[model samples]
Target chain A: MGRLTLPDADVIPFGSPGDPDRPGRGLGPSKAARLVGNTGPQPTSPPAAAAPTSRSATDADRPEHSTSHDVITDAEIPFDGESWLEFARRRLMGDYSVDDFGFDPELTDRVLLTLVRPLYRSWFRVETTGLENVPADSGALVVANHSGVIAMDSVMAQVALHDEHPAHRHLRMLGANLVFQTPFMGEVARKAGHTLACHPDAERLLAAGEIVGVWPEGFKGVGKPFGQRYKLQRFGRGGFVSAALRTGAPIIPTAIVGAEEIYPMIGNAKTVARILGLPYFPITPTFPWFGPLGMIPLPSKWLIHFGEPIRTDHFPEGAADDPMVVFNLTDQVREQIQQSLYRLLVKRPSAFG
Target chain B: MGRTVLVTGVSRYLGGRMAALLAADPQISTVIGVDVVAPDSPIAGTDFVRADIRNPVIAKVMGEASVDTVVHMGVIATPKQAGGRSTMKEINVIGTMQLLAACQRTPSVRSLVVKSTAAVYGSGPKDPAKFTEDMEPRHSPSSGWPKDSVEVETYVRGFARRRPDVSVTTLRFANFIGPRVETALTAYFSLPIVPTVLGFDPRLQFIHEDDGLEAIRTAVLSPRQGTFNVAGDGVLLLSQAIRRARRQTIAIPSLIFGTVGRTLSPTGLADFSSEAVRYLTYGRALDTRAMHRTLGFDPMWSTDEAFMSFVRRDSADGEVDVA
Candidate 1:
């Protein structure tokens, strides 16, 4: 039999705050309830009484949906379970949509991204800068150096763009054929919005106005020994360059530091890898000798820095067909990424700092 | 101009339906339905002719009737439907060759329409997201009806080049799903416990039976030269389709994935061969912009809508709704 009251912290974090200039418009049961005494559950509450003041304000006609939503947010602790149950029910009833590339946005955002967020945030403690270089909308190809033998670097960058960027753009990655050949990894990668590293797939994603990511270094960059770490590998015949040229999408050269220390490959068992039909059997300091537990990535300090976009629109038509232009562009992107990687290395205090 | 049209494979559902449809058209003076066996049910408008297209006798039928428009819809999809794999290949490859040879000889034929399956663009992991009409399959179909289709299209092209007067329209239709129609996919979905490849949810595209027939009708009415990919707009994920069907799914390991349809589903109907397994592993999509701009055919149902329509008829409750 008392007025509804809540602390500001109880408000939902999802919605932005309403106008402070508009009095009594915040759906504030907090300040008003304390002042109005225990004359409980009255139809004429303080907010209703002060409605006239709000009515005279600039946004009087605007609804207090945000205020109500904010209050509803975090109001009930068990709502997440209910909402998740609802999501499951919807999924069961086939009420979701997916892109032609088999990208399930709902599942990716709610499940896949949520699973990796902890690793990106606390475990790796990834620091990302220069994300503003990525366009808010429109197609842009992100060319990053591949590292972290397990491909954690790409996923970490994906998480960074989704969580940190202003646009929250989904980076549709161009993965190696090997990724799609594997069972669970292939399925998860597609759901996370990745396709084959072929030119057609890359061009198609770009044409659809999506931010596409490609690691040109591929296996060589990831499988190199710890001693050879941070040395740029051959950027795959400039296929990514031609794709950018054809789509007229800007190529963003990205540099990722700290991934090299994750596994620290000391040697490679070539024959065993070939027998197992794998690219290379990596022999990291703790791997194979320490068993599955060694699979755990070291908590290396991570820094993902996105550099300025290399414009492809300025080039004349048929530049993609010209090997000279493509090779130069590929080299330019490589140098930019390598330089930034060194810069980030100097900026960081230590490996696990 | 009431010109006579000859339709092949009239015993099959789609082929029979196509014949009846063409027969009903006032523009066509006569619709002759040719096949190896008698139609199961009586066709209303079409004049059934029990003649095998693989034989030179088909040329006689075309010549006597003075068939001007040839609608070849006889390419059987499943081995069971054709009795065996060899027979399916014989009918698809050899029958197509003979049919094209017959078409080339018949001077009256002016418009030739072939119903091709999108499976010709073989599915593989290293495939593009969407394949255009000109793009070749990354992994050429090693076996089954997909390879047969490749051969069929080739012969059709050869016939096209030999006779430039005829307007050759090849409509590459995606998997068909509807209440009345029966296909390998429908048979697979009808299994008691739907089995899927573990760790893979392939992208699926479907065309409603009505939309498919309408596409054929569109091409027949307004003949176009180049091949066009025909399917309802949008795509449905295999997992989404399973959920929509309200079926329990068992994920089989990829190692044992090849024989899933053969072992689980009824003995013969479902054709989950190597090419099909590859499709279930990594799905294929078609670029259908040309279907709209060049072919001038707009499907009434989107991909998911076509799938949901099938699901609606599949279950007794018929209560399919978005959550």
Candidate 2:
């Protein structure tokens, strides 16, 4: 090593240009070859040879073996695995802030969404419709029906928007307070671009030209019994409508089918939910019987249909403050999504088809 | 252009340095540096007065000097530094009470600048993302530097009410980190294996040492009348700060960390106080609108840059460079 000592060498191994945290594997041969070209005995390589000798001459007065080897190498040593190093690098270099809401895109892309993408693609076999309804590049609220014992439906919708849509827009999802209060889940949710389902967070995201997704029905939609599958619940107190009105974001009412069948909730374990400090402990058919294995969602064919955008810009100022306008808009959005669910159900042959 | 200024706590680095800066100004005729003990390094062009602020005789210093301005920079940061917990309280709380009392008595002292910390806004889960100067803390701090700061501010408020003519400026600063400032935060970051509260990556804001001194200088020169939240803009998460320092972090369960940290603090392994633990768990950020809009002063460094400056000077590789 002519000039490239431990202090001068950057410990963060350049993996890929756009995303350094994205692992670049099987590069030992090429990197070793480059090292040979730089430090080899052959002095004929003009460009590489000239670069080091000139710098080493400038460093001539500097003592040999001055750079602390044992101490420097110990701190600079990358861990064994690629992913751990990526995680450590992200954690160490302050590469965690992707959004003001503490969403780390690298973490979401490489870790969280990486785990969800397979489930959305192969396991659920989700086929999205009316992707054109999603605004190609601007801010729009995607209001979808929520279900499944877990919020796999919402996770899949996020994957759908990111992977399939023409613009590949990232959904700044509005999650429940429960999702943000729970220990590990809270961090994962925030890193995956999910903030509290509050108006301020929603309005800010929309104002910044972000696609925000909200399940207005909330736990009522997710924790509903199997008998009420495909039946829509109360669309909240119209908070999402108020947020859209405040920001003038067009509301794209989305309908997601087959999430209702993923883990069909047959009973409610209210006592257990209370003890565990959860909103609701859903008891499904295979849940109590098969244990952790039953938590695995069925390979239900998912149909996500995006309806036409409902314009809120035409409304005058203070429309968000007006309860009647907000109520009507909420009802209109709820009606559109309900109708889309009915139309999509007619086309589907079976839940698993 | 001739003005007499009294700078308190000249024994400390910030206080001693600020007094020297004040003295160097041609407009200022006199700079009197007051402290309990003589400063280790001399403050040029300033008369050093060895007198504790806790004593009643400090009132005589203000009265005799005919001081027009008072810069109170005598706040104790840690109990360990002040000899013990009770002594820390006496110096921080009683010292402020006496100083404010002396200012109240002296009619000529029209300008008062107090060095305060952002710990007045206690860290808790219910706290707002950014705390404005006027907003009350969600949970009022019960102990340590936070509680003392709150008590000091209360006394200052009382003083303001009594002497409405006086221009009172309180600079509630974020954690100070720079090339030379060895604050509690710096000490924590300097640890080989930094212990972090599990599942909480709290956001932290820092002001550079130069920025902090500049803020104090600005307060002295301009004589603003308001309690301002002075901090560098933007924020760095606790984990990110540790990472930037190139220090290894061990995620410790909060309960276990609490016991171990408390045990180790006395041994001088760490400067972990209950207030510090709360801060590490739920970090605080200040809304610097008052600093920018009202005070009309801009910090030289942002939050990230201030933290990086400290890291550049303190990291393992930089150790040799520092020497």
iRMS per model, in Å, is: 0.9, 2.8
Local error of candidate 2 at residue B282 (angstroms): 3.4
lDDT of each: 0.80, 0.77
C-alpha TM-scores of all predictions: 0.87, 0.77
Q: What is the TM-score of chain A in candidate 2?
A: 0.74
**What range of 10 consecutive residues in model 2 chain A has the weakest lDDT sum?**
A65-74
Candidate 2, residue A92: Cα displacement in angstroms equals: 5.7
Per-residue C-alpha lDDT of model 2 across residues B44-162, encoded as one tens digit per residue: 98999999899998899999989999999998888767789899899999999999989999988989999999999998655555678988887788898899999999999999999
lDDT of 1 by residue, A213-302 (tens): 999989988887776667777888999999999998888889888788899898899999999898889998899888999899999988
Poorest lDDT segment (10 consecutive residues) of candidate 1 chain A: A66-75
In terms of lDDT, the poorest run of 10 residues in model 1 chain B is B314-323
Tens-place lDDT per residue, model 2, A1-353, is 13223332222211222332433221122232232121211223322212111122222222111111121111122233345667765565665554456666666655676677667767887777665556645678999998887888989888777655434467889887667545567667766777778766788788887889999889988988877777777888999999999888888888898898899899999999999887789888899789999898888878787676788888999999999999999989988888777666655667777
Q: Docking quality tier of candidate 1?
A: medium
Best by TM-score: 1
Q: Over 4 Å off in model 1, which ranges? A: A1-82, B317-323
